[model samples]
Target chain A: MATPLLDKVEDEAAASPYITVTLRIRRFNPEISDEARWEDFSIEIDPKERVLDALHKIKWDVDGSLTFRRSCAHGICGSDAMRINGKNRLACKTLIKDITSFDRKTGATKPITVEAIKGLTVLKDLVVDMEPFFQAYRDVMPFLVTTGNEPTRERLQSAEDRERFDDTTKCILCAACTSSCPVFWNDGQYFGPAAIVNAHRFIFDSRDEAGEQRLEILNDKDGVWRCRTTFNCTDACPRGIEVTKAIQEVKRALITRRF
Target chain B: MSADTTATGSTAAISPVESVSVFDVDHPAPLIEPPRKRTAKTPKATRGNFEMAAWLFMRLSGVVLVVLVIGHLLIQLVLDGGVARIGFAFVAGRWASPWWQTWDLLMLWLAMLHGGNGMRTIINDYAERANTRLWLKGLLYTATVFTILLGTLVIFTFDPNIR
Candidate 1:
């Protein structure tokens, strides 16, 4: 047992030349701290490793108290979305090699900054209260709406009709795009990009009967007008959903009652 | 992981009449938005096309502004000795023509509106507080109106030969 442990240490040292990275994460402990503070932890990681992996190592090996949200580890769940290197992105999706900049003099690792998405209240380290995000999604009524369905068969639709709103259907409810929005950050009540993206999914659906109602809900002053076409949402979206274009299409649909 | 309200406290002690969300999955609360002063500021449903009109106007005016501004520069500066040869006589000569007068007038109005709207958007984005935003926008509109009125007066009342 003692021999294996010593050999394992040797194996790790002999492993591929790993890069040392400093993760400057914003920490907030509601119980202990009155204000949020930045904490740095240096870890040796492979060039291909993700920010999430570094967080896991810090939580598991370095400090068990380190906290963050992660699921599936593959960017599908949209749970690990945070500001990575000053831009909103999925922690699992962003790699350390791409974001890190090295100091030319000493070749030292420049710290990678990570913070919670803006606008929402942060519950603790890197975990925000997502209730407000979910509430905006709910306000848009994100499910397919139909009435008086007597046919037991699946609603038949042409391929062209399905392609109409196909782009918006790719949204995984990640608030990266929404939270990066300046308007949403300014006004808490604004519907934000996420809600508008979800609305576009159903408003363009051929079989949906309640398109008018959803359009009515989004036609208010806070609905589409608040969007300044800043392109922040489009840049922040890890899914490449073309969030700004979807918002424009929604705005056009409001003017001309046809989607 | 999602926010775990369970670890926050016991369920029995929570109040029943609370308006905000009590639970994530069950007994969800409706999103309480800030009360919009819709009556005075943003028009009602019947008049919601105001923003739509403004949006459409920007694109159309931008296309026109491009033509007007480029034509203007080409005649005054690019075609000749750029800015060195231009003088009061040059401006007086151009404004004397009804065609140039109308062109300048249209450009003035359109450019002011476009620039004013652009500034309003910037103010809205940068100004964090409500009162600050309102004050900034109010000043923007006032300056925009003043400039527009003054420029319109100059165009219409210009006498090429004051002597």
Candidate 2:
């Protein structure tokens, strides 16, 4: 098995499709030192491969102590969200060629920077403490609530009503949008875009009867009012949730009391 | 063999019990505090519509201000011989009409409130400390109130002929 794998790797190397890429990772370990530092690793890899694959290569081959969080290796799980080249993106979704600036004349490429998402405490290297993000999510009451007897069948909803909140339902509870927000970076108390997006999902749902309660909860001082309409959350959302638009809708609902 | 067995028995006696657990259901590990945890010192949510009203007021006043401000600017700066024609006499002549008085009054109030609210929002966004925010807002409110009052008095009790 080892001989066959080595032969396949050699065959692939002969194609010369690989380019040298440098990954600059911001590392932090409290057990060693309190301050975080940048570490670089240069590897020869296919340009079409993901930044996550490069991280894996560095961890597996170069340094076994290199740490980061990743699961599923696909975009759907949202476990590998990190700041890639100063923008919040899923590491698995970001291709190496897209982030690394390639020079045609010299055949050189810029180093891809990977760091933990902002506005959250870094646990180790790329992993962040997600407790606060989840706290905000929980505070929004991101679920349907109803009074009176349960319906024998499902609570009926029209196609148009379902479409109203269709965009916000794609959230994967990733901190990309929240951590990208400038307001949240300064004041963590503010319920960030992800929470507001989740609230919008339930607030507009025809089956959710607790819309008023959730609205009241979000009407707090640290709620949607803090959003500066910076559009950063919209730009950072991995699911293309139109986070800012959903926030605006929530604000409108608060004002008009109409979905 | 007897001596070796005695040494082994003594070593086993020194070892701690394996059945005893450090943490159990009754005495568990302490929970880590959430970064943005709301403590007792944290103020309760106002649970008011003040922010919504402020947001809406910004838009509504903005639309009205566009018309009022543009009309005032055109009259003062561009129309009827431009800035050269504007003087004490021009102001008195404009204030003689109730329509102009109402326009000026509306413009003064709306502009002050709009700008003041914008400053309040900026203070809230940037000010990290609660005391800092309070003091800055106090100063802003004082300045805003003084200006509004002085402007209102000037508009309402205008003595055009005062030397």
Question: Candidate 2, residue A128: CA error in Å?
Answer: 1.4
> What's the distance in Å from true for residue B92, model 2?
1.6
Candidate 2: tens digits of C-alpha lDDT, residues B15-78? 2224443443454434323344454577777888788778788899999999999999998999
In model 1, which residue pairs have backbone atoms overlapping below 3 Å? none
Clashing residue pairs in candidate 2, if any? none
Candidate 1 ranges with C-alpha deviation above 4 Å: A1-20, A46-49, A95-108, A228-230, A255-259, B1-47, B78-93, B159-163
Model 2 agreement with the true structure over A21-69: per-residue lDDT tens digits: 7787887654444456677777788878898988888776666667788
Please tell me the interface RMSD, in Å, for model 1. 12.0
Q: Sort candidate 1 into its docking category.
A: incorrect
How badly does each model clash, as a count of residue pairs?
Answer: 0, 0
lDDT of 2 at A183: 83
Off by over 4 Å in 2: A1-13, B1-40
- TM-score, prediction 2: 0.86
Candidate 2 chain B weakest ten by summed lDDT: B1-10
